[model samples]
Target chain A: MVITPQRNIVSRTWGTSVGKKSVIAVTGIVFLLYVIAHMIGNLKVFFGIETFDAYSQHLREIGEAIFGYEGVLWGIRAVLVGSVVLHMWAAFSLWYQAKKARPIGYQHRQRWEGSYAARTMRWGGVIIALFVIWHILDLTTGTVNPLGGDESAYLKLVASFDRWYVALFYILAVVALGLHIRHGLWSAIQTFGANSALKQNALKTFAFVVAAVITIGFAIVPLSVMTGLVR
Target chain B: MKLTLRIWRQASPEAKGKMQKYTLDDVEPDMSFLEMLDVLNEKLVLDDKDPVSFDHDCREGICGSCGMVINGNAHGPQKFTTTCQLHMRHFNDGDTIDIEPWRAKAFPVVKDLVVDRSAFDEIIKSGGYISVNTGSAPEAHAIPVDKVSADDAFDAATCIGCGACVAACPNGSSMLFTAAKVTHLGLLPQGQPERATRAINMLATQDELDFGGCTNVGACHEVCPKGIPLASIAQLNHDVLGATLTGARSD
Candidate 1:
């Protein structure tokens, strides 16, 4: 395939504010869906070690006949990684633009009294990104898992959460992720052009509830383990 | 009412601006904000001092020329009101108000309380002109429009290009202004042929002019003089994506 060197419509728009934001909106939805799914899978730990461990192994076995061993799992990982790269790229680009546009701020720049979640979107995103790395090391790859990679998924989770510091960190990261979602979900709704006067209230409520649900769902596991409810 | 006013003073575009204080007595509650400024200017004239320079054209709030940050909020504390129409009644007797130019890199200060806003014109020009045949006036009923779109277009057409949205936005974004134009034209039958290119060029130019990226802070919507809704930005975003997917060519 010969790629034309000349600037085309696609290339021009891709570097623009609309282009970058559209990208963020699309990738953000992917993460949103993935987190909800991951939370539901984690809740399976309540069903006992056997069922939870079975679920973890089942992720690798999905579509075994058609895609071969671990193919579907790898595919999911590929999409997630791609989403992360695009999401961060667009987010940083927007951040740089915003910073450049307002070199001189107001002497008494009255805060718009925006939601705390909206105000902390950038820093919250950074915290969430860092947490993703730690989470992958501890749970997915088991490189830092105290119980080791060879142990059952349930045991690995329990062992990681059994440490008070690890559990506290998990709760902190979960809250940051939730706040990120609270702002991001509504921003995505606007970017997609689905927001309007009539639907604004309902959609705002929906975004808040979804963010709250995801935060609680993830945080509960670490709390349960620390409290000895899931040991 | 006696009030202390802290106004930004910049002699030239290259000069370092600073806040200077002035005491304004005999400020009547019925006097418009600009009228109060006139009283202050008269006092300066008698003192043989250079008067404070600000932008104002139509004091009735129709013209887009008058805009400044009053006490950190764009167009002062009133809702759906312009600085030209903001009366003195809103302020307390002894209130100390801070007045400054719109502080965005895209909008540079020209003098005291006045900033260069031609960047908005550049963004408007890049959107390209509508293709209308030059001839006698066409019949009114020749091209019919539905009521909903017509009303929506009119609602968007109310934008006066005052730059209040930029002053109000945390990101210094001009999306609301660009969105108003795109939505006004996009909703009409005459705007169809160039709709895609309009969205692409206008948005691209807005970015090129060094305006900030919009994060949907909702401040712009709240402080808008004409009450332009945040949904107009959504509509503009919708048009942009729709245009891109169709492989529309740009100039």
Candidate 2:
């Protein structure tokens, strides 16, 4: 790529917010879709340990085991990773600039009475990131104890959720994820140009419900395990 | 009504900005937002303080000059009014209102609530105008334009370039503003000759400008005083992608 001084200087300068926001919105949509797909894949855990592990193994053992090629799933992962990077970079850059614009606080009673969703977006994101890190470690690494009971990979999941606090933390994280996703999803659609009042309201409501379902669905398993509803 | 105002104060572009609070007692609810600011400035001048600076031109809604993020929303709480047209009646007595410039990388603070939006001008300069040879003005009736197409184009053309869309957007994307202009010209019969080229140039320029990519957030259309449709953005994306695919093969 040709790099003129003006182009290089302009690139370093803070670009327009509208432009950045659009990128954020589009990348956000891609990330959300990936999360939803991931959540659905995890739903395979509900059936039984054999079924859950088999499902996961099937994902890895695709093509050679069944279809004779692992093409589509790898492609999907590649797209998901690309979208995640773009989404994270855009979000981080926008946040940094917003912070840069203000150096000091005003002596007014700050009130964000009307916009709870927008205000919590950043925090929600943090909570989700932490949760993802923990989740990956718990499921993939075996570094954390699933609980005090079984050390077996499958048994760890069931055993770990037995603790009320740990299970509750998952539940809360899921709730935050729902709230994050609800606001994020609807906001992305709006950013992309779906601006009718009726449509906006409808999508906003739909996002709220979808996020709620995904969050609750994932959270329920841990709670069920803690209560001995699922052993 | 007595209103407490928290306005951003910055000495210069490099100086760190802060929100300075002041009280305006007996503020008339009927006064426009700018008029209320004027009252505050008069008081500041009396105290030997420099008057607060903000952008304003043709206080009517038509001019795109006046814009500020008031209490988290662009152009304040009122639905369609620009900051200049926003009235104090919408606020409560003794209510402290927070005000700040449109926060974005592309828009730097020149002064309190006055941002340098020249980035927008640069984007426009890149390919926003139709290049035509100098000649007599074309007859209005010579080129027949469908009323609906003309109206849609006019509606898209109503973008005031206030940069509110960027401020409201989560990622600070300018897709809506740039897309609106692209669609406005691309919709017309006269614009067809340069439509493909215009899309490629404008889209590429928009990316080159370091503006964030379109995330499809509808905040731009929501806060737009001109009510620019978000559909135009989708159309612009489609056209840009299509143009890119067909325009040429340049490695």
Tell me the tens digit of each residue's lDDT in model 1 across B54-162.
9999898989899889988989999999999999999999999999999899999999999999999998897735879899989989999999899988999999999
Off by over 4 Å in 1: A1-10
Please report, as a residue range, the 10-residue window in candidate 2 chain B with the lowest summed lDDT.
B242-251
**Candidate number of the best DockQ:** 1
Query: RMSD to native for every prediction?
Result: 2.9, 5.6
- Candidates in order, TM-scores: namely 0.95, 0.74
Give the C-alpha lDDT of model 1.
Answer: 0.89
Candidate of highest lDDT: 1
TM-score of chain A of 2: 0.79
Q: What is the C-alpha lDDT of each candidate?
A: 0.89, 0.72
Window of ten residues with lowest summed lDDT in model 1 chain B: B242-251
